[model samples]
Structure formats: structure tokens, C-alpha cells
Target: MSHTFDASVLREYDIRGIIGQTLGPDDARAIGRSFATLLREAGGETVAIGYDGRMSSPMLEHALCEGLTSGGCNVVRIGLGPTPMLYYAEASSEEIDGGIQITGSHNPPNYNGFKMVFQGRPFFGADIQKLGKIAEEGVWSSGSGEVTERDVMGAYVERLLEGLSGVDVGELADLKVGWDAGNGAAGPALERLAEKLPGEHHLLFTQVDGHFPNHHPDPTVEANLADLRALVAEKKLDFGVAFDGDGDRIGAIDGEGRVIWGDQLLMIYAEDVLKNHAGATIIADVKASRALFDHVAALGGEPLMWKTGHSLIKSKMKETGSPLAGEMSGHVFFADEYYGFDDALYAGVRLIAATARLGQSVTELREAMPAMLNTPEMRFQVDESRKFAAIAEVSERLKTSPGPDVEDVNATDGVRVTTKDGWWLLRASNTQDVLVARAESETKGGLERLMAQIDEQLSLSGLERGESVGH
Candidate 1:
């Protein structure tokens, strides 16, 4: 059967779209066929499949299985779980030749997509574009391949819990915790971990609902964290935790209802790991706070700033043999004593273990970190075709009329200018038609100045500097 897919559905990172609209069973099947064919051509024989808790995932999984089997690749369905579980399965199973995760990954619940890995490397960028072209041209090779169902959840949970065996959680005996899963795929995994944890645990939205009857599953957005915050405050809980749609990223609120951004979480995790792996390399994306890098350096660990993207960060980690790496979006990769995959469940366990060892509350740990005022990620809409050009314009302007005594300028991801007071970054989004900007300083006034610098640059690029643009 011939199937058609919108060329735009194939994204730089993965295939994603709103179900029944840009995506459906047919698209899933076609994607499965194309992906399977790509894998087979790359010498892959078996592929692992897993899905999130979205209502559409099960049907999508079945359709994808049909396509994979028809494309001459055996499918090992790992049933329902987070994207990380699929990554774990691929890393642990020797028979598996590749894997595909059916997940929207913190996007709206109605959205669903795939994250593919072939031959142990992320199958992204040009590979994803190729799949779309194949589907559009109705190019698929036919072969008879078998399909098998497997219950890897039990083993998956066992591996996760087993990694925590040495961690001491005794200090958390008196801690009162609130967990909000936002009805994503992480609910079950968080519930399982809660059962084994020692504390007064309260769960919100633990049931899986693809409709996302509550707020969106993206915890990084401050608005999405409102419910978790209220719950923490109402219960006077020690801390609150939330997960993204696929459970690979995590968000947390201290006892005082303060959001501990991912960079802060990385600081805490870095300190813990540095003790064991002294002088080890720790990586964080350029979007992360400077404080995280400073903290890592102060703790005697090498801090490396790299490009944004989970797959990009993972590849850098492997190249540098970094023990830990995290993105501001909450994707935490731990290669110290575990597989170098971003697993929020494992991150939570580590956080719990670290707090227990500190004998202090989550708020206390936040207080210990250096204080810096940071603007929330500001995103402004731009024509998809003009986004990169805008960035280039700003870069050229900065190069010609450089700011006063700019200490350093890093254009690794975009333009990150560091001055005496603070730093500011402006980058074009890879997934959307938006320009992202962020500024940070030790003082509020300095932050404003840094933002003003960004505004001037934007103005030079013929971009409007309005509040609606978000500063």
C-alpha cells in the first residue's frame, strides 16, 4: 500500500505532529516502513519499539509494527513506557538492532512523534529528512519479517531501582513530597518509585490521560508548574517534582515553592558526581546558567559548554567521556555509573539521594547555590525562512560595532556575549519559527542592561523589541 507524508512532518530531531491531523495510523505505518527499511539497509535486523501514555500511542504502535514487519524487520514491542525506557531497552538488549520511541516529548498531549536510534547512534537530521522523501515518493521495500511482544517493564524497573541500591535515602524519612505527573507517560514510573521511597508522598494526575485534561506536560514552562506549586504550598511539602510527557526531563519546586531550574539541578548533581569522579568532565548546553559551569569548575571538575539538543549533548558526552551532562530543558544524561541516557526517573532518584546525604532540605540546597537573576527564555516569532538570517544579521552587527570591552563572544549555538557584568545569548530555534534569547547577571540592574544590549541587536536586525516579544 502506498502512503503519503507531509514533508514538514519530518523534523530535524524526529517525526512529530498533532495526531489525526498531520499524523495518523497511515503516517505511522509509513514512518515505520521507511525507518525499518533505513535500518535494514544499514544492516539492522531487529528493532525495539516503545510508546508513551498518550491515548493514540497504542494504535500507532500497532500500525508501526505492521509496517516494520512488512519491511522485513522484526519488531519487539516493549509495551507502554517513557521514551527513556525505549532508550534503555536499546542500550541493554544485545539482540536489538535499533529502536523507535513513540513520544511527543513534553509537547501538548495531543501531539505525538517518534525518536529513532539506529546502530547505537541518533538517527536524526538528514536521516529524518530522507524518511519523509521516501514516504512522499512511495518508496518502500517489501519483505516478510516477524513481530513479537515483550514485557520489559518489570526488567526496566528492576534496572532503575537496582542503580539506587547504594544511595542512602534515610534522611528523607521526615520529608513530605508532592509529585505531579501531569498525566504523562511518567506517571506509572513515578508511582513505582514513590512506592519504594520513604516519605509522605502525594501524587497528582497519576492516571494516564492522552487528552491532558490538566495543564500541558511541559514542566519547564512556569505556567505549567502552577499546579505543582500550589500543591506543594498547600500541603507544606518538603519539595515538589514534575515530569515531561516522555519522562526524560524533570522539573522541581523547593519547599518554598521556588522553581529549581535544570541548571541548578545540574549543579547539585555535579557536586555529587565530582566527589566520586574527581576532575571529571561535566557538560551543559550554552542555554544553561553560567552558575552551573562556575560551580562545576569550583568543585574541581572540567565544565564544557556545547550546543543545545539532547542528541547533540549525548554525542558530545561520548566524545568527551563526560560523567554528566544536562540541558536547560531538563534532559539529564548520567554516564558516571549508569547508561548515558537522559532518564528523569534516575535523575529524581539521584536528587533524592543527594538531598538525603546533605541532611538539608531542597530549599537549603538552593540557598547554598550562588544567586543570580536570570530572565526566563524569551521567544519571539519570526518567519521560518528568516530566523537564521536574523541571527546572522545580529552576528554581523556585533562583529562590526562590537559592544564595550566584550570579554568574550561565543557563537557555538548562536551569539553568546560575555561582558564584565553578565552574559546574554540569542539563538534561532531549530524546531520552530522563533528566536530565543536569555540574559543573566548578579544584579537585577545588570540583567536589564544585558537585555537592553540584546534589544539593540534585535533592533539592528529589523526585529521589533516589544514586551510581547518577551525580554
Candidate 2:
């Protein structure tokens, strides 16, 4: 019964791979049996499972169920939905103790993966590695556990509407907004949400087409938001919101067709959240704009910067009891009155509520932010063996002599260097064989200086910036 997985599919955060080559039914079943064993050992029996709209999802789901039942782990199949719906099924229930979502999550159509939650916490990093180890060792419990289906789509939509609870409906009467689901798993949920939401709504590609016939589902890339911006502009809507493939990350556009990066969106969310939970801690990844950290401080809230990766951020939120947290990559978590999971659908609803509560348009909120010149996240390939070592090399050099302008060096995740001009970050991507770099400064000259510093460090490590790599 021993099975060895394609090593590449076992990632730091989740199990993911190109469909036919690195991952398939065998891997899915291994994951299921291994996960079930872990859950049962922890005194938990029920596991919730859901799948995205990807073409291969159903097949994987069926095989996954077989493995789960074989291990004596009861399975609650929530059917096809976004990753958050599965999160909801697990979080909103006392009966379920763990969950797994079959989602590629903004990756290309040919890719698929699994995101898991154990007990109430993110099952990642060491947990993921352990799952792989258990699979390879072929140690699994045996029993026949029942499988049943539960429809939570309607309840999930209703739960999202709660984000707009306190807002005045009259203020929303004339509001016109645009939505682009990008044909991912969030499409159907978005449709149901829009019908119940107040205001005029224009939806683009709400049909769940795994092919992504329109634009790519990822909203973090500005190019992918072209259709969303056009929809907002043509309809003259108040604003627009977009979702990644599995609906865990969010991207937004203002009424003026300006793309609001993830950090800027966090600024708005921080203000709204701070209004209620004054002096609460708000967390963002190191890659977030300095403006966001500054804004949180200016609003009289404590701002904490932490490592990237959704699982890491979620754990930090629990540790600090942070009400809200976000990543520059568009993953936002709200623990104030909801579960502490990144839910883009809920974020969209909060955007509407934030506008109404703040008494300003989305564009106005965006316009008020400090103007900072920043580079789009730059990723360059490095040998998998060299990625983390390269970052350590850079950190070591900075620690020895950070130069005059360098204010401080934070190595929370990787190494983030702060200079009087601004800040720059160089970290190894947890899930990829690449180094991610981002720099931000108030002036164009300052930005250039910051970028130069980045290059100098890379050159010191015997590595050039090289051609940029795609996500």
C-alpha cells in the first residue's frame, strides 16, 4: 500500500502541481488517506471537502472520498464551490473538525491543488510535509466512514451579506457596481450575492468556466483587471471587485478605473475595522506598501508586519488576536465578526460597506493615500537549491554593514531593508523556485535608489536580477 508522491507537488503551503505530470487521482487519494489518519489521531472524525469548478475537480473529489472513507474518516461533501465555501463549512460547524479545498487558486487552468485546514488552524508547512511522509510510509487506518452531501451555497451568500449589516439601504439605492468573477468557482456565489445586495450590479463572466475564457482569474496582476476596469468605466459604476480562481484573494477597481492594489484595499479595510475595534492590531505582509503601515498608525491602530503566505498570516492573526490582516498579493482576513480566513467574496461586501460607512466614494478613499512610486512585484527564477540560501546571503551582507541610509533590517520572513528613502524586500517565494522583490519610495529618485540597493545585494550573491518570472 506504500505510495511515493511526486516530490514537487508537496509544497510549503499546499500540495499543488501541473495536472497530468505531477498530480492526479493517486496523489489525491494518498492525501485523503493520510489526512484522515491525522485527523482521527487528533480525536477528530468528520472532515469537510469542497472543490472548485475546474474540469478535473469532480474526479479528484470522488477519489478523495474513497480514500477518506477507507480510513474511517466521515466525509461531508459540500459539492462545487470556492475554497472559502469549504472553509465556511468547517469553520461554521461544530461537527466538522477539518477541511480540504480542491482549488488551483488563480493558477492556470491545467493546474490543481489542495488547501487544508486541521482542527481550526491552517494545516501547512510542517503539517503538509508530514502528510507527504505519512503517504510514503503507507501507514493509514482502516474502516468504512460514511460520505454525505451538504448544500451551503445559499447560506454562504447570506453570510456574506452580513458584511453590509449596519449600512443604510437608502445610501445604497443608487449605487452601481461592477463585478468580474473571471469564470472561477466564485461565479455562482457572486451571482447569488449580487441579487441580494442593494444597488445596481453588472456581472462579467459569472459562469464557472474552468477554461477562463475571458481574462485570467487572478486580480493581483493589473493586466488581468483590464476587463474589470472597462466594465466599471463603461457602466459608470461606483466601483468594481474581482476574485481569484478559487475566490480567496480579492482585487478591486475604483470608480475612476484605477486599480487598487491589495495594500491600498487594506488601508480602507483597516479604517473601517479600526472604527469599531479601536487600537486593534492590523497585520500585513512585508511586501505591503509603507503607506499602509503608516495609515494604520495614523488611524491610531497598531500595525504589525509579518511574513507572506496565507497560512502564515492566519496563524499570526490567531496568535495576536488581530481583527484583520492582509497580504499585498490580495489575500485578506477578517476576524472581527467573521472567521479568520481570507475570503474575497466577503471582502467585496465589506468594500461596499466601507464606502457607505466612510461617506466617501471608493475613488476618494484611494485618492487620499500618499503617492508612492513602487515597482510591481518582481520575481526572478533561481535554482530551487539556491533560493533560500540566496536570501540568507543577502541578509548576512546587510547585517554586517547596512550602509548609512539603511534604517533597520527586519528578517521576519526574509530580509526587509528600510532606508530613509523607503523600504525594499527580497524574499524567497515559499511555493516557487524564485526570489520575489518589491521596493517602494515617495519620490522617483528614491525609488531608483531603493532598486539599486536591491541589485547591489543580488550582485553580491553572484546572481543578477535576470528576466522576470510569471506567477
Candidate 3:
């Protein structure tokens, strides 16, 4: 039997699409076969496979393992878990040559995808495209290999808790936490953590339901965080945290129901990290608030701005030997005390510990951070094909403009124009068909001026702007 995989589903980062429409068992099997062939050609013999709590995951995993075994690749199935757990399994296990995590991440329930690692590096972009071509060609190597199922959840949980020794959460007995797993793969792991931690724990959406019957798994958007916010307030908890579908990223709410964004959370984490590793390098993506970068520098750490993408950030972390790196979307990587993978569950423990040590409320700590008027991530509709070219155009135009106030124009990821008032950024999102823009200023009028500048430049690109001012 032959099958055709949609080329469009082979994205820059991973193979993703609407489950039934663009992806199915056949697609999964083909991907597994192609991926195993690629790895085997690269001298691989074993592969680790894991999946999130999505309802379709079991079927996909079964098909994928079948394909893997058929392709002469031994498969180690780790069952249901978060993307980070898959990553951890790959990183720690010497038995596997590569790994794949079947997860939709922060996308809607209808969406399902894969996060792959081959030869210890992210298998993405051109690699993902190549996989599609292989599937399209309907040519793959076949061999007989064996499959084995293992439950690594217990070991994973133990590793996560053991890392908390560096964090003194004051016995955890006096702590109170409310967690909204958003019905993600993190529910089971979080339930285990709750039992081990010395806090009064309240869990929401503990059941793993791929439908996401309660709310979307994306916690970055404020709308998706309503349940967490409400739970925190109703329970009068110390703090609240929510995870995306695969649990690589995190969104948090303070006791006061304030949404502490990823950048802000980084600020709090960096304070402690910097104390131990003075003058250390800390990386944040271009979309992160200027406050985070500035704060890192103020605390005697070097701040580096880099491109967006978890793979890109992890590469930067390894290159710079940075102990920590994060994106504005809540993907926090900690090489400080743990492996340099984004683990929301581990990040939660660090967050709570940081707050406890400060002896200040999460809201209070956030309030103490430098005050600068800023705008939330403002996304404008754009053709996915044109978004990058449009950003390149903007970068080119900014280079020719004349002014000393234009301190610097950085095009590492997009056009980040630095002026005396503050800084503004316009970048093309790698994951979606949108042009994302953000601005911050020391003063209100300064912020307005920055927005106006961005708007003027966006107009040149024939894109519409919306009211995303004053975050």
C-alpha cells in the first residue's frame, strides 16, 4: 500500500497539521519509516518514541513504532508524556540513537505534530522537508527490528525532584500552589510532583483529554489563562501555573491573579542565577522585553539577544555556555542546575523557590521590576511566504534611515530598532502566518511614538495595524 503525505504539513520546525484532515496513521507510519531510514543511513540503530496526552496519540505511536521496526530500527516506546520528557529520555538514554515526541504543543486540540531529535540535534527545517520528500517518493528501506515499551515516568519524576535540592522552598509544607495542566501531558507528572512537594496542592484538568474540553493549552495568550487565574484567586493560593499541551512552555499567575509573562519570569530566575555565576551569559530572544535584558545586565550578567525558536535558543545556550535562556513565549531553558531543555514542570519548582526565598509575593516581585510602558505581542495577518521577505525589507529600509537616536538596528532575528526612548521589534513568527511586533518605552508618549514608527514602517509593507498599545 502507498500513501501521500501533504507537503504543507512538513513545517519548518516539525510535521504538524489538523489530525484527520492532514495527518493520520498512514502519515505517521511513513514519517516513522522515513525518519528511521534517515537515522539508519546516519549510523543509527535505535530510536525513542513518546507522545502527549492527545487522544490520537496512541494510534499514531503504534503506527510509528510499526514503521520504525519495519525500517530496521529498534524502538523504545516511553508512552504518554510531555515533549521535555521525550527530550530527557533521548538525552539520558544511551539505548536510543534519536527520539521523536508526538505533541501539538500550544496549538489547538485539532492539531498534532512531531518534535524530533536526530544525532542529538534538532531534526527540523530542511530535515523536516526532506522527510516529506521521502514520503512523497514512497521509497523507504525495510528491515526487521524489535520494539520495547518502558515507563520512564518514575525516573523522570525522581530526577525533577532531585534537582530541587538547590532550591530551598522551606520544606514546602507552608507553600500553597494551584496548577492548571490544561489537560495536557503534564497532568500525570504534575500529580506526582504534587504528592512529593510539601505544599497544599490543588489541580485543575488533571485528566488527560485531547479534546481540551476546558480551555486551549496555550497559556501565553491571556484568554487561555482565565481558568488558572480564577483558580488562583478562588483558592487564595500562593501562586498558579499552567502548561501547554506538551508541557515545554509555561504560563504563570500570581496570587493576585496577575499574569507573569515569560520575560518577567526570566527576570526573577536570572536574579538568583546571576548571584552564583557572576558575569555569566544569559540569552533571551528578540521578542523578550528590554527590561529582561537590561535587568540581566544590571545584575552583572551578559545579556545576549538571539533568534526565536527552541532549537535556536538551545544551540545558543550550548555555544555561549549560558546557564539559562528563554523566549517570550514561556519556553525557559535551564542549564544551570538541570539539563538545558525547556521543562515547565521543573521551572515551576524554581519559580516557587525563588518567590519563597525573596519573602515577597510574586506580584510584589513583578511590581519591583523596572517600570517601562510596553505593548503586548501584536500580530498582523500576513502571507506566510511573504512574512520573512517583508521583515527583510523592513530591515533594509531601517538601515538607510538617518538619526543618532537610532542607536542601533539589530537584524539578528528581525528589525529591532533601538532609540533613546526605548526599543521596538518587528519579527516574522516562525510558527504561524503572522508578523509579530512589540515595543517598550520609558514613558507613555515614548511608547506611542514607538508604535507610530512601527505602524509607519508596517504600512510600507502593506500590512494593517491593530490597537495593541499599552500592555
Candidate 4:
């Protein structure tokens, strides 16, 4: 049977949609058939599957399994959990060849999606688009493959606990931290984990309610972190850590209710990681703070800045054999002693481990970092056909003019220019029809200068930098 999917449902990293409207059970079946076909082509026969706590996940999981078994692949259903648990199931087992997780990530309740892994690496980009092509061709292999269920939550929790290595386990009980799951899929796993972890741990919204009555699961947007902050303050906790809907990305706050951004967390992680693997190449997305890069270099490690997608960073990490990598949006990947996938839960564990090993409080770590002023990601809707071209024009103009105080320009992802004030970045978003901009500087006046430079560059590109931009 031939099938087709909405073009919008197929994204750069995963298949996502607004449930009922952009996707449903039929699309799930098509995904399963296409994924199984891709695996069969590579001489693989077994597949692992997992889903989140989204209300619609189970329905999609059932339909997806039907398609996978029909396409000559045995299915190992790993039950409900986070996206990384699906990754763990696929990677930790010898019999499993691939995996997919039904999760909506940080989208609203009406939304749901799927994250896939083939063999042991991330399956995304052109691989996702290929799923559409396979569904269209109706070339799926026919066979009645077996299906079985496995409870992986216990094992997944144990693996996350492994991130606490290199630190005293007794110190954990003395650590007081607040956790907010925000009623996302991480709720159950968080509840299970907190019980075994040593600490005076207070949890918020651990109930797996897809309705998200407490707050939106996206921890990156500062507004969504209000509840977590309140909890940390009320309990006088040492720090706080939060998770996105599917638990792949992380967000944190210090004991004083200050948010520790993704790049800053990378700095903390890097300090500990560097001690073990000195002179290693540490990777961060181009959007990260200049301080992070500088700090990595200071720690006797090579700092490499790359593009902004998790999949792109993972691919780059594989190509460069980097032990640690992260993005501004809180996706942290560690290949030091674990699978190189972005796992927020594991990151949270490591944060504790890092603090204990470094003999500093989370608040102290925050206070020790360099202070810089910067804009939150300024995303402005742009015509898809014109966005890339607009960046290209800016990159070319920077090359010839090399505006005031401009020290150098790097067009790695889009256009990143360094100056005495600091740096500015302009890039077209990979997932949306928007252009993202960010600038940083040491002082308030310097920040203004950097912003003006960004404005000047956007003006030259026939685009206006105004209050119209949305993050």
C-alpha cells in the first residue's frame, strides 16, 4: 500500500506534527514501514521501539509496530520512557539493530513526533526525508516479524546513574537540589531516579500528564522556568535542573534562582571532562558564548564551534572523535564513558558529579564564570527562499568591507564575526523559516555596538533588524 506524509511533518531531526492535523496513526505506519525498509537494505532485521507519556504516543506506537513487523523486522517494544531510553535500548543490546521513540518533545499537547536511531548513530537529515520517499514508492518488504515487550526503565535509570561516577556517593545525600519535570515524559523516569539518588531532592510535576497542567515542558524559554525557580527558592535548595518534554535537552538554575544556560553548563562540564582527557577537542555550537570557547582553550583543550543542530553536532562529534559537545539549547553529548547522544538526565547527573569533584557549589560555579552581555536568540521570520541568500549576501559584504573593529569573520554555519567588543552571529534556522541573530560583548556599551553592527548588516541584506524579531 502506498502512503504519503505532510511535507511539514518531516523535519531536519525528526518527524513531528500537530496530532490529528499534521499527523496520525497512518503516518506512524508509514514511518515504521519506511524505517524497516531502510534497515533491511542495510541487512538488519531487528528493531527496538519506545514512546513517551504523550496521550497519543501509545496509539502511534501500536500502528508503527504493525508496519515494522509487516516489513520483515522483529520489533522489541521498550515501553514508555524518554527519547534517550530508546537510544539506550538500541545501543545497549546486541540483538537490536535500530530504534524509534514516539515523543512530541517540547511542543504543545496537541503535538507529537518520532526520533529515530539506526544501528548506534543518529538517523536524521536526508535520512528523514528518505522516509518520505520510501512511503511514496510502496516498496516495503513483506514478512510476519515477531514483536516482544521489554521493561527498560530500570536499566535506563542505572545507566544515567553511571554519570555520577568520579565523585563521592556519600556527598549526594548532603546535596539539596530541586527538580521540575513539568509533567512531561521525564516525569516517571525522574520519579524513579530521585528515589535512588542520594540527596534532599524535591521534585515538581513528576506526574506523567500530557496535559502539562503545571507548566510547559520547554525549559529554555525563561518564562517556563518560573515554577522551577519558585521551587528552588522556597526550599532553599542548592540548585535546580529541568528537562524538556522528551528529556533530551536540559535547563538549570543556581541556588539563587539564576538560570545556567546551556553554554555555561558546558563550561562546567568541560572543566571536569578536561581533567580526565586533557588537550581534547571540545565542541560547541556557533551560538554558544565566547567565554565558553575561551574557557575550553584555557583548560588546555582545543575548542571547535560548529553549526546549531543536535544532529549536526553529533555527526561532527563522530567525524572529529570529540569526547564532549553541546549546543546553546542544552543538548549535551558526552562520548567519554557513555553513548554519544544528548541525554539531559545524564547531564543532570554529571552536573552533580562535577560539583562534587570540583568542591564548589553550583552557585559558586556560576559566580566564577566570566560575565558578558548578550541577546537571547533573536529569530525573525524570513521567506524560506530568501533566508539563505540573505546570509550569503551578509557574509560577502563582511568579506570586502570588514566593518569597524571587525577582527575576523567565520562563515562556518552562517556568518560569525569577531571584534574587540566581542562577537555576533547571523544564521538561517534549519527547522523554521527564520533567521537567528545573537551578539555578545563585555560591557553594556560594547553590546550596543555589536547589536548596531548586526542591525547594519541586516539592513544591507534588505532586511530590517527591529522589534519584530521573535525568539
Each model's lDDT comes to 0.86, 0.94, 0.86, 0.91
The digit string of per-residue lDDT tens for model 4 on 297-326 reads: 999999999998888899999999899999
The runs of at least 3 residues in candidate 3 whose Cα sits more than 4 Å from the true structure, single-residue gaps closed, are 1-4, 168-171, 356-361, 466-471
Residue 166 of model 4: what lDDT?
Answer: 69
Q: List the lowest-lDDT window of 10 residues for candidate 2.
A: 2-11
Model 2, runs deviating above 4 Å: none
Per-residue error for 296 in candidate 1, Å, reads 0.6
Clashing pairs in 1: none
Tell me the spans in candidate 4 whose CA falls farther than 4 Å from its real position: 466-471
**What does candidate 3's lDDT look like per residue over 1-471, in tens digits?**
445787568877788988899999898999999998899999998999999988888988999988888888999999999898888888888777899999888777777889999977788888988887777786787899898888989888888886567656565677788898999999999999888876798999978999999998888889988988888888888889999989999999888888888999999989878877899999999988889998999999999999988888988898999999998889999998888989999898888777666667677887797787888888876787889998888888888873666888999998999998899999887767778898999899999888888988888888767544221
Model 1: lDDT equals 0.86
Error of 4 at 207 (Å): 0.5
Per-residue CA lDDT of model 2 for 387-431, tens digit only, reads: 999999999988998899999999998999999999999999998
Q: What's the CA error at residue 39 for candidate 3, in Å?
A: 1.3
Name the 10 consecutive residues with the lowest summed lDDT in model 4: 462-471
Please give the lDDT score for candidate 3: 0.86
True-vs-predicted CA distance for residue 291, candidate 3, Å: 0.8
lDDT of 1 by residue, 158-203 (tens): 7777646565656567878888889988888778778877778899
